[model samples]
Target: MCWINKIESIFNSTRCSEEDKVRFAVFMLKSNALYWWNVESVAQPNVLQTMSWEEFVIRFKTQFYPRTAVRQMEEDFLKMEQGNRSVRDYTEKFIEYSQFVEHYVSSESRKVKRYILGLKPSIREFVIAMDPATFSLAVNVVEVTERNKNRQGEEKVVEKRKWEGSSANFRSSASFRRPKFIKSDNYSSKQPPARTCPRCQQVQQETVNPNRKDVTDAERQVIYQGISLYLKGVFNAIHLIIFGRTTHN
Candidate 1:
């Protein structure tokens, strides 16, 4: 119906002649009528032979959208919910169903209330907190909030992927360019050769021993020599005293 209205508006805007507009409308309707059995039957040569565009639309709408169907549409509108659907999709669905009873939902306050009631809980809370004055304002706020949330979620995912990729690349490149272990000729030359002489080796062994005593060979020899010299001097002094006494008697 909206598409038909758009075509009609284009014809009016371009100032097409009434005869041309009628011809175009009839062609479009007949061309599409074959797809639907009811439309094909209703759009027969005799029924639409003398019908105008307005008359054809009225008849078509009357046949398809009866009073019962319009009442059901109103019920559907009342039960509509935004659950899991995007705000734009929900809005389009609500508007399409509400068209059947636009007279009742004409007021801004009523429309706003109905729209807010159908929104998903998360978005509804934010919108109500904002307390928009008009239905348009409510829609704008909800849409913006949902878009921002979606954008942030996408950014987080992208950041995580970038971090993972960078870490993997760093590991791969580090493995490829690592410095190899090359044995240098000068490495062995820099270390001193081990001592081979018996005396030097023994000294080295003693120096490295953890349990060796603290006394040295030079200190023991000095102590023994001093005792021998003291004994010899005492014996000579005794002999000299005895001989001198005997000669005096």
Candidate 2:
């Protein structure tokens, strides 16, 4: 079928005569195709001389592209849908399949309708609403619609990622800026609290007498011992009052 189309394309471009078109196409045949053509020519010697390009195409398709295959191609074309294919890919397939089922897409309106029906629903709705009169216009509309839908999906994904990123950043920043209060077991270790002796109410004041210069060294030592004992008793009283225990003497 591709070879047939290529031959027709060359014929159309070069404006070749019918005889030249058939000859050139037969000349290009190779391997199995060449063998089949040789056998067909021997069976019908005058076929090439009498056959036009159109007649040659008919005979070639009858031999290689069987009726059953053509029918299956037509069925496939009728059942075609966009499925997971991109709009461009779907369009290319539609064009290829439509060639075998020309009766279905004989008119521009029918061709456009068939093409639109085969598109994915998301794109089909917009293309139908646009009501394109030409097959090309319909294809263009569907392509644009598909692109827009894809772009919107990508944008939604981007927005969701951005939102998640911002939420993560906000949580991190909040954790960083928030103050944490830690509880310590040794609260009084750094600076001891001031406590006064309950019995004294005031600290004891020690005085030195100038007249002590005439006193003996042993008498002065006895006075110092008495003051030290009194101060020790005062501390023990303070400790007992605060801690429920007396300091050892």
Candidate 3:
């Protein structure tokens, strides 16, 4: 469907909160951008009966990004399901509804992005599908992870390309030694070697320069370990590179 009409419908929706509306909107926008917007994905990945675009889109989101979209859709349904039902009586039903959706949180990207946008025609034509309590819950996951803060500094997406059997960025970047205290406690207290990466297994004793134009194999490993640390939540730190600050729960 036209994107603008969908927005009008949601905005006029009195039952949903402001947040659900936005979440539904985002879900739609992202879905259209990914699936219907792309051609090859149209034919049935499954039963290929020359699927109508809408039927294919819904099925795709349900099978793939259901957590992203279906979970929210389910939430919206449950809230309505319970709107007339009493909290005291329908509490168990509510929990069941939530559990049903949460179980699918890890659905593939196709489904997940659809959920994020609420399946608008532009998007939904791609799982266009939301409610009051449902909308609140939509933001809750983001809040639990706390990914909603205003960004600081530059909004950047660093792309790493593979080259010559090593990540090009890691292979060529200079290494930064940790401070003395970190070195002592974690890195075996070795003093920073003058102008060279001591961690590298030196072979044939070529003159190792810390400022070498090309990083030795050791530097690439260091970069890999550093990324692993970030993903593992080893520490909450604000690098000037990401957001102004890295937050931890």
Candidate 4:
């Protein structure tokens, strides 16, 4: 019917002659037919020939828009369900299907009830609990519910990601604080302190005065002993800082 009205408006507004208008209208209708039955009906030359544009439209409606067809559309509307679609999409489908039975569900209350009944169970309870008496109110409630549900889901995801991120950070910090074990060729529970030569220490200090002779092998050994003592002190400091444990002498 809408298609017929649109085509009629176009021809009526144009300068096309009555004959041209009827021909164009029939051509458009024939070209738009979907099934083989429709195609065969439109292909019949005598079907709508010699009729005015207005008479052709009347005949077209009489042939296609039967009362039984409207009843079938109403039955299809009753069987419609939201299924797994989003609330918004389901609402659109509900409105689209209701057009067929718009005359039957004339009152706001009936439209509201019919629309809500087809909604998914997840949102249907809350929508009904609001006790919406009109179709607009029911639609508003469903839209709000969908928005709030989406927001809460997003919040939960964000919270979970934050918790996981914090846990990773804590583990990273703990790893930095963890002690490192030092392995040696002769690993022992305790390490021995370096031995220093007091005589060579005094000799080296005296030799720096420039009044002493060249250092002897025994004095040089003392110098090496002093170097080992200094290195051992450094190793102990490092072990305490990194491993939080002291090397026992």
Highest TM-score against the true fold, candidate = 2
Error of 3 at 196 (Å): 99
TM-score of 1: 0.46
| Candidate 3 lDDT tens digits, 23-123 | 44435655655454344344434333344434544554454555667557576743433334333333344333443455443344422342334321331
Poorest stretch of ten by lDDT in candidate 2? 184-193
What residue pairs are clashing in model 2? Answer: none
TM-score for predicted model 2 compared with the true structure: 0.67
lDDT value, residue 152 of candidate 3? 19
> Residue by residue across 6-105, what tens digits does model 1's lDDT show?
6688788988765566566655654334344245446575644465667766665675578898888888888899999999999888777766777757
Per-residue lDDT tens digits for candidate 4, residues 168-231, read: 8988896667788655333233233445567775323222212235544445565678778999
Q: After superposition, how far is residue 74 of candidate 4 from its true place, in Å?
A: 3.5
Instruction: Report the lDDT of model 3 for residue 153.
Output: 15
Better structure of 1 and 2 per lDDT = 2
TM-score to true structure, per model: 0.46, 0.67, 0.16, 0.47
Query: Tens-digit lDDT track for model 2 on 49-138?
Result: 877888877778788888898999999999999999998899999988887788999999999988889888878889889999898888
User: Order the candidates by TM-score, highest first — what do you get?
Assistant: 2, 4, 1, 3
Which candidate number has the best lDDT?
A: 2
Model 2 CA deviation exceeding 4 Å by range: 175-249
